[model samples]
Target chain A: MALTGLFLCTFLLVHLIGNLQLFKADGGMAFNVYAVFMTTNPLIKFTSYGLYAIIIFHAFWGLYLVSENKKARPVAYAMVDGKANSQWTSRWMGVLGTIILAFIVMHMAGFWAKYKFGEVPYVQYERNIVDGSMTYGPSAPIESKKEQFVSAETGMEYTIVKDLYTEVAVAFKEWWIVLLYVLAMAAVSFHLVHGFSSAFQTLGVHHSKYNGLIKFVGIWVFGIIVPILFAAMPVYFFIQ
Target chain B: MKITLKVWRQKNTNTSGQFETYKLDHVSEDMSFLEMFDVLNEQLINEGKEPVVFDHDCREGICGMCSMYINGRPHGPKHGVTTCQLHMRSFKDGDIIVVEPWRAAAFPVLKDLSVDRSSFDRIMSAGGFVSVNAGNAQDANNLPIGKEIADEAFMSAACIGCGACVAACKNASAMLFVSAKVSQLALLPQGQPEAKRRAIAMVNQMDAEGFGACTNTGACSAECPKEISLSNIARLNREYLSASFTAQVD
Candidate 1:
């Protein structure tokens, strides 16, 4: 469970970085281009599919272990007292995971679904096949194609291809939506802060000579990367 | 000086509990916290009120029985000390002290400030014993253990099973208790016979007891009266991993 969880944590950093591209200055085009690349790339497609499997397995197994632990003691203690010794975040991983899961669903629906099947209005531009002269305007209805080249602003109309940076920027610029992304990232960060080192410990990687270094690295990876990647999204969109 | 005591009173395991307040007057700063509790009990007895029930075997701190959460801190704000070892001078004259029992799902409160820590006993029973048969005491020279391993095992064995580690832990994890038992046995040659079973059974029992998982917070060791090391938990993890791997065939 911890191994899978740690893997998920690693995936979060990459996922957050990919999502952060949405907030780039070129509107949503850069993000959409990145997203399109991510979706169409065979390697990313394989890894992401594996990532989905890991998330489901980790979540269900974690819930199973929690329930099994709960069943060990059927009765509640009369005096509910230990608040001094445990970390607040460690104590509430389940709640945090649940919240993050909800946000993940929302995030997928908002962006992943939109990029995949949702119709996005695009501007059309006429281009001379052999020459550089062209007129930019609203293009005809050209259905989304898989791995096919398309102009960022003018969509499929421009034979001269462009990236989807503008679409990504536009998607992330919304204040309320960016706020939710930030929150989800925070949850992911907090979850990773404890989960990363814990996985190593559980996997018996605790050698006295190098355990400290390993834990330190784990802290840096989880404590720093997830939040910064997600936070960069809003900062990039709003500031730019 | 008068101190307000908010004590957790539970009629029984089935019934819910609440904090009941009592006032203690003219408390001596020189008295230990348990001594102060004794004085209050004396007053309660004289006034025909039921005296507060709490667990305490050795007031000298070696027994590990004086487990109490005083003012939100286990063992009452003193580091490396049990509740019995805590001095009244640690508090101001008019301070209100909140006393409660260990609140983990495993350690159910039996009465006012008294919890059933037999979960520790059950966990220990799962694998905490050596398999030595009845016989004459062996000579100290029979088996010579390295001084360092002996010292480490003694430190781990110093844990009194007082449940203070759990009370001090924010997650109510009993890793300190479980690890101490595992370490104590794992350190000696005599413990080798059942080492793997001991680790597996005790950890399984610990999980079965509904205690929260250890997240390596180190709070349990910090608040331990005996100051048991967190490294023991790491050792236990090693033991558990080895045991689980070997047990795959068994």
Candidate 2:
């Protein structure tokens, strides 16, 4: 559970940085190209399979731990003052993890599955490679799709890629979609606040010398920064 | 002062339990919680009724014989004190206090508030001791251990085996207690020879005793009467990992 959880946490950081390309003002050129690279890259594609397996294993393993823990205490306390001794997040990890798993399914179906199989609007950018100027072209189907080509008549470079960036914008435009995305990020934030440092403790990395650093990164970076930034993408799209 | 008590009453392990309420008058604020219980039991005797049963000893706190889930928290709402050390003054004059035994599959209730903690005894016997050939008494200064290491070991040694850790845990995990025992010896020089085997043996026995796996919730430490630090648990994990990696298959 600790190893897989930390792996997923690292994946979240890389994913967050990659998705930051959306905020660029270049008409989704940066984000679109980045998406194509992420999907089509041979190395990343293979690693993603392992990432998927780890996620599934972590989720179900967490549930199994919950059941075993439940059996340890066959009877419940008549009234428990759990808040006095511990953080609410630490105790409810199983519940928060379940929510995060559900969110993963919803999120993947909304964007990842859509980009891979659904009808994605295409954008063709015609650029003067020398002068750094650009233009847009009509959306007629090209029988042979090339990532970049030289237009004979215009004597300029043209690049065509699936416009997944626009698909993200369209999906986030709905209030409910934006709300769900924000809520899921909240769950992620809470889950990670307890999870990140806990992984270290379980893996035997805990000590006074490094505990402060672990806690700072756990709460501020993964728990607050990463989730908030991921959440901002949807809100930015909705408001804009 | 007057107070209402809702205490758990059970005949034995085979029978289910129920909450029974009793109203008492003329309670003094200065009386300890157990003294108040004593008064209630005296009242029950006068009325020819079976008095409520609970576990307690050494009334000071060192014995760790007392186990009570008072007002939903083990050892009551007071921090860093056993049930014996808990004063009645912590509650209001009209408070209704509820008390129950430590509930865990490994620690079965013997009666109303007393449980069989022989499982902990079994775990302790599994690896909680050091074996050496009998010889003449060695000088106390022979060890030459550092002060910091000694203090850390002493802190872990303070664990009174009070099963409050088990009672306080949401999962009823005995990791805090098991880890304390492991740290008490693993930090010292004399304990080095058997550290690997001890870690593996104790944890295996702990699992065999039906204790839940630890999830690193700080509840056990927070509720500990001795305030045993959670750092011991981290050290135990380190020791267990190192042991497992270096352990012999033979």
Name the top lDDT candidate.
2
Residue ranges of candidate 2 with Cα displaced over 4 Å: A141-146, A152-155, B133-137
lDDT of 2 by residue, B141-168 (tens): 9879899999999999999999989998
- Can you write out model 1's per-residue Cα lDDT over B1-250, one digit (the tens) per residue? 7889888887887798787888988899999999999998999999998898988987999987887887767787888999888988899989988887777788887887888889999998899999776377689888899999999999999999998877766557788899899999899988988899999999999888878776566678878889998788878988998998886445
RMSD, every candidate, angstroms: 4.7, 1.5
Candidate 1, A172-193: lDDT as tens digits? 7788878887887788777767
- Output the number of the TM-score-best candidate: 2
Off by over 4 Å in 1: A16-34, A41-43, A60-87, A121-164, B133-148, B215-217, B248-250
